[model samples]
Target: MSTLVKEDLFENLLESAPANFTEARQTAKDLYLKLGLPAPKEEEYKFTGITKKLEKSLSNFNQAKPLSVEENLIKESVFQGFEGDVLVFSNGKFLQEVSSTIEGLEVSDILSSSAEIGSIAKAEKDAFAALNQASFSGGISIKVPKKTKVEKPILLLSFNGANDGQVITPRFWIEVGDFSEVTFLDQSISMGEEAYFVNKVVEIKGGLNSHINYYRLQNESNQAIEVSNIETDIQSDARFTSVNISLSGDMVRNNLSLNLLGSNSEGNMYGIYLLNGKTHVDNHTNVDHTIPHAESNEMYKGIFDAQSRGVFNGKIFVRQDAQKTNAFQQNNNVLLSDDAIVNTKPQLEIWADDVKCSHGCTVGQLDEEALFYLQARGIGKVQAKGLLLYAFAGEVMEKIEEESFKNHVVGLIQDRLGSKF
Candidate 1:
């Protein structure tokens, strides 16, 4: 109930780590202890009290050990019927490669990485990141060679399961060489019945003149609590696109940050979240234009039903040297029930005189006239509402390039919405 619990948790985690990582891990632990976890009073975490959730869910959690998952579980957890090179991780440890479709892709253990591990997603940015850097094990690093264009998507599936309480920290480091192209589907699914806390971090680096498309899907049980940090650095003349889809979870918070560190680089971000029951979902995004001749666009939309709550905070920063920069951001939400709550804030800060930037947010109910228009054409009320809601969410949903993955997401969306035809 006090700092003793936090200190004990930190010490126990340190004692459990390998001796080889003591120095760096101790540095990270000190950083975490200095800043501590996110509380309700912190402006950045005001809407989501993730620390309490982590403490309550992971206090009595069992010690993490080697875990092996059934092949069928990995098969089902992946995108159903989707064809691609699949990498599976069970309980924060790299399990195996389920399917391999491409060649010349370099894969290594997370512990095998040195300078590349914390290069982009610096642990100094936040306490959760620091904690993950200090305690994670069995993560994996992926490298795509220069001039190699992967023809198919790479599916990375991570599943977490334990007796009752669980604390799983998984890390992913991705590096792409110059003039290369690839697509990745990063997904997480819950495999346990009781409460669990999952802290995940993903770092991505884009080489010059390269193109990268990233998709993240989070589908967890009602008793799951999760926090995910995705950080990306883009080089000169490169293109990066990321789409995050959150379908189900009890308490979920996602931090997506991007830095355009070179000239003529571009970044695009899209997200969709549908929350029901007592679920809570928070999405925080940051885009920084550190150089000239760069552009970034961000858009996120969500629908809240029942007693669910949703929060979105988007920030765009244009530095003094970032001339000729163009940035835009938008956050929109629709509340389906009276008890549903949504908090959205869009911000833009530009120090460059020659830059163009804009940000806005909207929170409102479903369209009444549009619903009536559909119902007047002999369509039932529930079906008409479904049609309208689907149309509202379609703008971002249609961004998926893979047909099979899109279809799988469509099925999950329908299953969650439960609207009649």
Candidate 2:
């Protein structure tokens, strides 16, 4: 693999694009220069050796004809009863033929919506997010009308390339107007025929008093590699909640960042990950309280088995003037095998004296006492383990208020456990 840097890709992308988008691309390119890839000495990325693991040759790629992915694959990957618009991306290309458009929603391509949204993706503190903006070729742009509330959930489906060493990059931008409410479910799945790499970037803008519920499902084959970034700006009194589920991947890394730019805004982040058979998953998140009277809560849980590895790193920053802020973060993990590994860190950087902020993390195995007690009650060992494991993961699962979606995730977890136990 050639030792290609982000600057090479950034320059090539800018040279190929039109002059109209130069300003936005230049901003991202400059940010990439300011903040290079994280080194091993960096505190936040100490445990995650992403730069070392993902050192592969960059392929000059672009949008292509959407793959002939099966409709059954789409039906099996999303939340049940979700009857809203569907945007499908196969092999990093927009599949408009298979996508659905909602009645009141404006779904357009990223380039098409630039005039109205004024360049949806920005380059600020995140290097990978900036890299995504610089190299992203195609994505979906969704806009909801002001004061409108959608009854159904919009689903975005993405599938990886079906050939070996094929890398697919898909990006998304979702915006909800003032006083609007909507639910978005984005799922990434890989076809089982070959090994592939999937890179995705998703940006969300929540208007004043708007409510947005987002769920991300990352379940691909063991040979797949995934890197996804999601950044959101919350307006005054806006409510945003995201639940991220990571089940299978060869190497999966997620970057979730939220900017509380307006007061009285609320943000909730919840994640659950299950891995086995040498799978590796990482979740890195940042929640910034830039304005006063903002509240944020984050929790992530994981279970690893049979030499699998999981990593969780979360940071909550309370700015100096952001008083009256309430932030809480916790990460917990369970190791089901002697070889299974989990590394978790919850960090809090507070400059405001009046803020209430706390962070904690724990890593351990299944409760031996609970297992023995269940066994004494004539319960099979495998069944008892599944029950205990379910209860361990149930903490974050309870945050899903929608019963149907919650139950569906629970069922998926059970199915995963049934295979091993």
Candidate 3:
């Protein structure tokens, strides 16, 4: 599990890559060697033992290869009533034939474009991001015109097919023009029964006075492992909101970072993780208030059943020049079984003299009083538990503006609880 071993493995993987990516791949290889993987001793990764999982998947790295999925599987994965333009990727390669036609947006294949796709997601400090940039086979770039408001949401579907211990890296870049509004539904799902690993990166830039809403749904197979990074930059008077829902995965780690670079910008993040069995999920969020009159808020909730484990870490930073900044963060967890474990941390670092900031975290079981009340009304024990858990998660789900999507999420949560009970 040493850095040299990983370097050699990645080097071998890159050997078959196209000649066009030689320079970028070399840069990533060097960066990976320098930064190495984050060990359990690292403060940021203290609670999550990601190195072990990485090692297990990388041991059979040579067996990793691209997989093609059936059309029926793709059709079954789509939301029933979704009216948005769909963009599909199979094993990190964009499938244009399966994607819907986009009208008001400009979309390009990142690999085919001549434009420079620099490191906008702070790859210098994030080892996984560096690896993704160095090894990503294909990706998409989206641009929204100034003053244009997209009527429909853009659905980005990344599906992983059956593969043996293979690794997939997908990259995405999004740019919102001034005074424009856009919504995106990004999802990751696995159709494979074999063990695999996915490393993905998404970078977003919001123009002045633009509005952006993003939803990330992770529904991988129980045997899959996913590590994802999302970085966003908000300009002056812009607004950005993100909702992350994690329903399934053996090991899942999400890194979300937001930079409020312009004055009067706003950012909000909400998430819910429902885990059972031995699944493990970790969420880390960082929001930076570097300018005056910016606001940021974050709320995350988790429900752990059986021997599942969950981790939440939220950090907000207010710089010396960030006067009049308003920031708030909270994390809550509910454990249904004695074996379940949760680690919650809410942090705030303020250097400004004139700023308002607060954070709080709590871990507990379902309210007995509410459970009794529901049972008294003739509801079954399992039904009562499901209702209470749904209520606990509804606080974050209410933030979803799209009614159909919210209802779909509700159904998924109910199904998960039913199976457990």
Candidate 4:
């Protein structure tokens, strides 16, 4: 299947959009065309074929249409049953009634923003990120005040609407002030049985000495397709921790990039992907160390069962001027069946002489030694396997500083493994 060129996809929308928006959209289209969908020749995308996966139709979603979801969705989608400010978007349009929780955070509709939003939208280079800015229907903008710390985590839910056979794009921008701290929980869900697509981009900016903990949980139906981008910029002495949990979708693609622009900055990234049946999940991450004395650590693990396929591609780049940089990245996977497949690549490109960078990847099945130890204690084979799987996955979950949140993730993974065992 061949994908449509940007010009062909945007001809009608360009003719109808406002002058400034149309110009921005046209410029974005030109950029995407010039950098056409990245092929294997691209260094960062060499192992992951993103363009081939996006060969499906790029239909424009209806901006004016609002999707109505059942009340139960709100109950099931809540994170650990604790919520502060909740912003919900169904079928890419903001639903205000079901998303009001607390006043600790300020939320605004992205489409209603004034010229300031457009100005910020012009500087992005990601293909999907730029496309979202050019034609996003509606999203939420979250702002945390200076020196303030949110007591509860903010929940951002993106659900597929009742649109029979259409695609949706949801875009969001988040800003954290100096000395502020916040936690955001994002989930993608489906409302009806109809097939849909979600193309989302989330851009975050953390100020000096601030902290931001973000969790992305994708749990859409098997027929749904999702492509997500989470990009962050951390300033001096700031801390950014991102945990991505992928447990749903027919075809899933994730691009997570973190840029350390200040000295003494720290970034911790961890991901756990559980795939089964015929599902395919691909996670690509890039860490850019542009300043001196920055530290970043990444660990991503995948468990593939049945005939599922998993892919992990991680790249860490240390600039020539970035001295005293310490970065470590690793990817590990477990295949439960002989037919299951995993493709992993851990890459490092360093130009600085004083930087410490290391990368390695492992692709195989469960550890026989550990399984045997469990079985020797009178545990059944199914129970023994589940325990070993939990042990292998606990390393990534330990990075979550919040006790309650960490326990919540542990529960989710345990439940999934229990059903299979």
Candidate 5:
């Protein structure tokens, strides 16, 4: 392991962090020192090659300090055709001048209102998560009061400034009160042509009878590398749903886990990734049913082209007391080119006798029979192929509840296909 702790990263930034998070940061710092960084020898990171990727991405990292950005670039980062309050963050500074406030939503950067800041995310176990906790000087916090339903989605836009070889860390904590409903859209953008690394962590808490929907769209630059972790806790009578859409990156790793702590809670996970060139992406997810009558559903699909690689590892766990639990998980992948590769693993562990659990994964090529049928119907070859691939991915897209965001995602996919299908 190399020396990853920079003097500026520790001494300068921690000075500005809120006082309430001191102990958590200290504990994370200690854990980071103890764990160093994960290598291929470690089981969790065997196929990702994250250690080498980080070493290369951070060879001359500068943290992108003293942020400076162009006006037009900020405009480009904003979500187009979306009606919502946009909260922007550049480097570590919250860009309040251009951000908007919602009526029934409480937003803060101080993080004082949250009691689960570090408790839900286990910083002691994962090195990257610990690094994020120790080095992130600022983050965003959102709260929905009891019985208050937010009509519009809240967008969190994060920008990594134009610093060569910099590291950007974005963190978030969200809480929803009982009987309330809300939606959150999270995105990250890179401004410069230089190489950079992004480390992010999100923790969400759902009160009893709460309904929450969270969406993450990732389309980072070709020179960017990232590690993201999302941890959600769902209470009794609450429902939590999360979606991840990844398009571009040099190397990316996403970790998502849901903990159903109360009976009658439900959790859903959906994801799609499109890869080309030499890019690499890995998605790891887990759902834990701790009480009786809990349910979870998960599905992830991928399209790999060129020499790119993809990996998916999903696990569903049912504890001894989690009787009457129902869990399902599946992963499907299509290789657009022979050189592309994929690794998928779907796991299920049950300790209860009266539980229904199922898991499966598939890796294959496009259906030639379907393509031939489409071509026979007067569709061009390119259009036929695009239609087949789009149809394969449309299942996950249908899970999105927001109409405008769904249309935006559809437009992105259509542009990528470059066909009149």
Candidate 6:
């Protein structure tokens, strides 16, 4: 990581960054210099080896060039029957011509706005987040005013173009005001045939008594690599729900952090990852209970086939001041192939005596008894496997509040499994 950063590739990236974020970029660069990259020896990253992949990707990386996209290409990526505002980005740059008009939301350019850009995504914590702050060229700052309730969900579409071996950074900042309610959908896809790297960071502030539901879907090209961070701060009585679905990528890593800053706040994190071929996916989440009476729950499930690999690490921290905190976490995985592998770890750190916290993880294959029972009932072996896998993954999918989105995910899972079975 140090050698890659010292190369001319990083210098070129810095030169192309927007002028308005010069100070922020320099700050991030300095932080990266100090922190470098995490190694496998680190407890948090022991199960995932990302340093080599990141170094190789950054060594040959060039800045993304402007892509000329067709209307049909964008239309093909949009969800059918979605009647909400859509924000599109090509090669990590915002495309206004294809974006829809959004009401009751204030969206501004992050580079030109006076908003505090890196307030929640501090460079001192995560090096990938710092790199995103240093290299991002275009991003948005969205604010939902107090007492406003959005009737439709907001969609953010990010598409990578045909340039091979380029590095792209996407950043976003969102603030949900007091008593507001909104749903946000974030989707990432690729139009390129060659392998590229995407580094993204998102910072969100949930105001007092606000309700925010966030959905993230990643279905990029099999040759693409991605590293993303989502940092959120929840205020008093606010409710924050995050659902993440990862279906395709060569190598994918997600870092999610939630700070329960106020009492009575609630946070829920749910995820499903389906991996095949030689793909690798890693999900790391941390929830900080800083105030008393806050509650948090997390559940993540995965299915790995062929020679694919998956990793899940969830940590919950109950501080001394958080006396009555209630935290629970669970991670479960199923391996369909002999060569497939999964590493799951659920951790709890409690400093208060009055808290109820528990965590558990499991990594195993499908139940043979269930398969035998299904086969006795006239089900084929392959069909039985698919049925069991569907039921295992459906536990997390059923938690999705949006019916349309949940059905869409079910269709994708069916399509992916239908070929294998």
Per-candidate TM equals: 0.95, 0.89, 0.95, 0.89, 0.93, 0.95
Pairs that clash in candidate 5: none
Error of 5 at 190 (Å): 1.8
Indicate the worst ten consecutive residues by lDDT in candidate 3: 57-66
- Candidate 1 per-residue lDDT, tens place, 103-164, comes to 69888768776536566887888888888878887678889999999988898877776543
Against the true structure, candidate 4 has what lDDT?
0.76
What ranges in model 3 sit over 4 Å off? 1-4, 21-25, 57-59, 62-64, 114-116, 162-165, 419-421
lDDT of each: 0.82, 0.77, 0.84, 0.76, 0.82, 0.84
Candidate 4, after superposition: displacement of residue 110 in Å? 0.6
Model 5, span 1-421: residue lDDT tens: 4355433333443344446677888888778777767756777877898877766666554455535645576677665678877787776455666677777778877344555667788997588898888777556788899998888887787777546436667678888999999998888777766777788888898999999999988887888888988999999999999989999988999999999999899999999998899889999998999999999999999999999999999989899999999999999999999999999989888899999999999999999999999999999988888888888889999989987788888788867765444
TM-score of 3: 0.95
lDDT of 6 by residue, 41-128 (tens): 7676676667777666454566786577667877887777666788888777778788776887888766666656688878778878
**lDDT score of residue 408 within candidate 1:** 81
lDDT winner, 2 or 3: 3
- Residue pairs in clash, model 2: none
Q: Output the worst ten-in-a-row residue range by lDDT, candidate 4.
A: 114-123
Residues 1-421 of candidate 2: C-alpha lDDT, one tens digit per residue: 1244645544554445434445676677677677766666766566666555555423433323357776777777667755567788877667777787688888877766752222434566566666656555667778898999998777778877654235565667788999999988777776674555566778889999999999877777777777778888899999999999888877888889888989999999999998899888889999989999999999999999998988898999999999999999999888888999888878899999998888999988888999999899988888889888888888888887656667777888988876224
Off by over 4 Å in 5: 1-20, 66-76, 110-115, 162-165
